[model samples]
Target: MKLENRRIWITGAASGIGEAMARQLSGVASLLIISDLNAERLLALKPELEKGITTVDALPFDLSNRTEVEKAADKVLATYGGVDLLINNGGISQRGLFYETTEEVDRRIMEINFFSYVVLTKKMLPPMLAQGFGHIAATSSMTGKFGFPLRSSYAASKHAVQGYFETVGLELYDRGIRVTVASPGRIRTNISVNALSGEGTRYGQMDPGQAGGMPAEKCAARYLRAIRRDQWEVYIGYNEILMIWFKRYLPWLFRKLALRVGKV
Candidate 1:
């Protein structure tokens, strides 16, 4: 779908891919609603984005908190009536072994990465369905397609996202609603550094792979392109995306390589 004069709401807009998307859509989208947990950062970004033709609104709330997410969604719907595009991009990552990770950590990750998206989408669905036209784009990870070490919960959450959106996409295809699930391999973001550990604390370290991954802006561009073309699934990354093919066509080789590369 075309972005021009479209009303768009993007979560996780304080940084990384969401921020890049907000910047890129500034002049194109008629109304831009940027949501994030960081109120200061969202407020700071609002002015920069509003300099263009877009009317920018910053919505700050904790995605992990169901009540907060609901309140935020209600506010958005009440204020804008509805949006043409909803990007569920706010999510936390995991960086602990399954055996070592607490159940709380897993639940927390699911709350942010999976449940939050569901809540927001459900809240926004009524209006979109009433209008019979809207696009929903979500940021799933490469792990959504296949498993990897040190990302058990993260992968599970993303897999859930992938399944949910695919089903939704199929159901909404003929109803004038579109869903785009973006499985970005790795973009240069603070996901790793902010990932939860076994005990639920921050991992606080950047993985070498993430540091050298594709730029967030590039990933955002690819994601938007996929949405425009009404593509169901789009993978954005460097050579790491090749792993998805290996897992699909050569499971044994994929397993071997996964074991070897997962050690790092």
Candidate 2:
């Protein structure tokens, strides 16, 4: 399916891959609904994206807030009758060891990263089923397919995302409900800077690997191409993507390599 004139809803559109996607799809999209917890950022981004698009708007709400997510779902369903393409990209990263992190932090990460996507999918899927076609895309991580030292909770959340979507993709393939899970190894984003520490405080610094990873716009381009092909799964990033191969074929060596890599 061509992206031109498609109704696309993107979460975490204020920055990173989401922002790059909005930029790429601005003119091609018929209705672009961007959402983020920061309303001001969303409002500010609207004009920058609406010049060529038929319609562009922002719906700001904290994904971690259940009531807010439900209300946002209602508004989305009511507006477009159902989201033609749903992009689940809103999430936080972890930077602390599992032993040091609190349960509250784990819950917060899961709420935003995993359950919110499920909630929105449940809400938006009915309309897709009614219409006989819809797509759901998620920005998972390479960690979703492999294990690492830090980011236990974040990795767990992403793993859950993969499991859920993989099941959905298999079950709904015949129903015209397509699923694409993007596994990005590393990108030049502020995810590391905003990553949660052991006490749930911000890490507040960018990691060198992230600084040197693939650019966000390039990653976004790759992802859009995958979407065009309706790919079930695709990996984005530079050398980090190779880690998936090592994990699959060289589990013992991958474990050793994981221990050797720089933390954060």
Candidate 3:
């Protein structure tokens, strides 16, 4: 599980937690592949990240596009022979009521947040299984554990991530493939501002809670620690993480508090 000299590929590396992970992993990994939809940002980040890592490759592709994901995966396997770690962190958020959101918006969110993870993992699994050693990590949200207003679709997608990875982890644990499902609470990221609305337009506003959340660098540090320890599931955040406990042990209270919190 040690990161030193490990070959790693991380999606959503253009910003937020993924970017922080790239920066931190660059110093430890022997070969680092950073993927994102923002080609300009990924290209700009490559040199900086390369200064630490032995090799850094910037791969830009839209996660929602299945064809693009397959192509990227093929390129990685063809060139590098496969990676020791695959972090499926590319995803989009939602900020709309269930009744108000369109089916297309829900599908789009699921496509990026849920299906993209599966596609990448499926394409990468053959090599991992052949090598009998690999690590996969997916970024889920606090909403993945429970629910919240204005996040119906987002929560559903994250919940799916939780279920899928947990099952994958169980299935592959005996085969030397480790899976880490990271359920991070609100981190100081632009997820809210970039969240899709009911009409599929950008929400374009930052929530107060997100603005005051933990720093992305700190969150990324915690994530790496969990990975190093080979933890199956890790939750990273401040007090918001306690909500998971409340939901598990005190569902009634959790429901009450959830209602009181209202929309973000």
Candidate 4:
């Protein structure tokens, strides 16, 4: 579980939580493969992160494109033998009412947030199994544990992530593969600003809650800590975590409070 000299691949590494993770992990990892749709940003990020530490490499691709992901996986495996850690962090967010959101929007969210993770994992899993040890981690959300207004599709996608990782952990742990699903509360990241609206447009604005939420660096630290400790799952952030308790122990209060939690 120790990350030092580990070969790690993090998706969405150009910015936000993925960037934070790349920074936090760079000094410790032997090879850090950072992937994103933004080739320029990833290239820009490389030297800053490398700075005489990890072997930082950028693989720019659209995660929604399964063909690209599969090819990328082939190259990655061929290059690194196999990654010791695969962090499934490449995804988008949602911020619109269910009724207002189009079917295409929902599909887009699922494709980017859910299916992309599945596709990349499928590509890398066999190598992990063959190599005899590996870890798969994912970023879920507080909403993944419950639900939220204006984020139904986002919540649904993360819910699927939470469920899938749990099942993977249970099914693969004995096979030399580990799984950790991080159900983070709101952390200051570009997710809200880039979140897809009902009409499939970027929200293009940061929510007040997000601006005041836990810092992305802090979230990344906690995520790495969870992986190091080999935890099956973890929840990061502050007050938003209370929502989980409320939903679990006080469903009525949770339902009422959920109504007033405002747009995330």
Best by lDDT: 1
Per model, how many backbone clashes are there?
Answer: 0, 0, 0, 0
Weakest 10 consecutive residues of candidate 3 by summed lDDT = 46-55
Deviation from native of the Cα of residue 138 in model 3, angstroms = 0.7
> TM-score, each model?
0.98, 0.98, 0.98, 0.97
Cα lDDT tens digits, model 2, 1-264, are 468898999999988989999889898989999999889989999998996755997999999999999999999888778778999998899999899999999999999999999999999999899999989998899999977888899999999999999999999999998899999999999999989998999999998889999999999999888888899999999988888999999988788788899444
**For candidate 2, what is the lDDT?**
0.91
Q: For each candidate, what is the lDDT?
A: 0.95, 0.91, 0.93, 0.91
lDDT of 3 at 84: 92
Report the C-alpha lDDT of model 1 over 123-242, residue by residue, as the tens digit. 999999999899999889999999999999999999999999999999998999999999999899999999999899999998999999999999999999999999999999999999
Give me the runs in candidate 2 sitting further than 4 Å from their true place. Answer: 262-264
Worst 10 residues of 1 by lDDT: 50-59
Superposition TM-score, candidate 3 onto the true structure: 0.98
Model 4, span 1-264: residue lDDT tens: 889989999999999889999999878898999999999999999998895558998999988787888889889989987799999998898889899999999998988888888888888898889888999998888889998899889999999999998999999989989899998898998889999999999999998889999999999999999999999999999988999999999999999888777634
Q: Count backbone overlaps in model 2.
A: 0
Q: Which pairs of residues clash in candidate 2, taking residues 3 or more apart in a chain or in different chains?
A: none
**Of the candidates numbered 3 and 4, which has the greater TM-score value?**
3
